[model samples]
Target chain A: MATIITKEQQEKEKMVTLVSSDSEKFVVEQKVAEKSHVIKMVMNCCGIESPIPVRRVKGDILKSILEYCEKHSKGEAQEVMEKWDKEYMDKAEKDLVFFHDLMLASHFLHIQELVDLIAVTFAGMLKMKSPEEIRQKFNINNDLTKEQEEHIMTTFGWAFQPI
Target chain B: MEVCGVPPEQDKTKGFSINDNADLLAEILSRLDGRSLGVAACVCRLWSGVCRRDTVWEALCTRHVSGGAATARAVVAALGGYRRLYRLCMGPVLERLPPARRDEAGHVSLSLSLSLSLFSIDCYERLGGRQRSSLLFLRNTVDVS
Candidate 1:
């Protein structure tokens, strides 16, 4: 015997469609979509019946962010969540360009936790590296005059000394 | 027209440069420690300018300073800015107390009267329990006479 499916039952499992900048559509559960504050605001004002257009985020980046939101919305145990977040970041860090895009997207979406995580990762890149190493890594030009560099180096000489 | 105070022209670029985004750059730099911050300040003109902002140094000072809010405020007020205050707090004086000042128990006794004179009436009172313990610690190592 086939169980009867009602319209209200289908409505109870309603989904929201999000369109990325490149016109790629992602159909996700409404709760998972609400993980992004930007989408939540859009839903509150414009109803979830229509697809929300995220014009600034690219398809791949939006997909990745949605994955993060889906996992986070589950409310897993603290230790498990931390382990997952670490693994997620580790994978993202493999491609600096993608990681940068993720950071920018998280910032635009008002996802504070992801922004903080990315910032910490960014800071970690410069943590123990010397000025020359940092300059090379970031492709930064040393614009400081000889005297200016020397003054800063000499004043905080301990920082330059081997730890 | 500006997204996060970044010029619209720079926002369309392929690669992200720290120089192109002020808010993101500041957010990343704020997570660095004093030593890392010092090295970052020498990276380039843009970074040097960002690292020199009082807000960055203030965050560093607040994290490193052990005393309460009153002590931090008093120190910052006396030193003029968080950068100067951080340098003084982390300087050689705190790291290596003069060997000549060590008491019989091998504790380096700071002069309580000198420290007390540095604080105003308001800060002195606000220091409360921390001031009392510090005074006791100092008194234990030094002679009053």
Candidate 2:
């Protein structure tokens, strides 16, 4: 049996425009842009004729996010995606500032998979790090008082030990 | 339901950190294991606060624990007291600790310091009908010793 491609189905492949915070314009397929829940919801309601402004995400972050969406939308094999995801995070992990901004953008756009990917990568980085190393890596202040720190050390001290 | 354009970007500094947002921080920390979570809590007040939220532990229980939601909630309620509960699923925290200080480990005595822990008994108490008899529970804490 021959399957028919309807006009409505053709609409799925239509292009959408996204404007980054700094006013850089991105032309993407509707399927690619729909990777963002926020964008998909808006396009569904208002139609995607006008370029949607992603007001918070900067151009660099939006570019990478779009790249991720475009890749994911291809319906590639699992190993390929996993490999792509690993390489994607490898680049993102080099700069904490950039990494954090990307996370913020992914969260804001409600892209659950990207958020999970970035988060899991972040967690993996900290998994082997000591408390002092984590503090140094993330530039966190030691806000715990002497007693509180002591208590944490006493209770979870085993976790700090070299396995 | 109609959102063609997102709100204008706010004037914020270039410096962006996940620590400033609890929700964001929780998302990252949620992907970590109980051991890393312990190390994470020791990082700062914000991480500590996020790590201790019942939701984080409940999520941990849900993933690493078995015997259904009630069991997960009970484990969260008991906090880290009932290490035995997750044994079937997560290999038990006890198995990870080097056995050199075997006797000194996991003793949740009815002491004040233990109460100060996020894994304190209040949650178990809050679980009410779960039979938290003080003697049995405390004695059980020493079973490994």
lDDT for A32 (candidate 2): 93
TM-score of chain A of each: 0.87, 0.88
lDDT of each residue in A49-116, candidate 2, tens digit only:
88899999999999999999999999999999999999999998877788899999999999999999
RMSD of each: 9.9, 10.3
- Identify the leading candidate in terms of lDDT: 1
Q: Which ten residues in a row have the lowest lDDT in candidate 1 chain B?
A: B103-112
TM-score of each: 0.71, 0.70
- B4-107 in candidate 2: lDDT tens per residue? 75332321223655677799888888877667877888988788778767676555544432334554355445454332222222324333445452223234
> On a 0 to 1 TM-score scale, where does candidate 1 land against the true structure?
0.71
Model 1 DockQ class: acceptable
How does candidate 1 score on lDDT? 0.72
Backbone clashes in candidate 2 total: 0
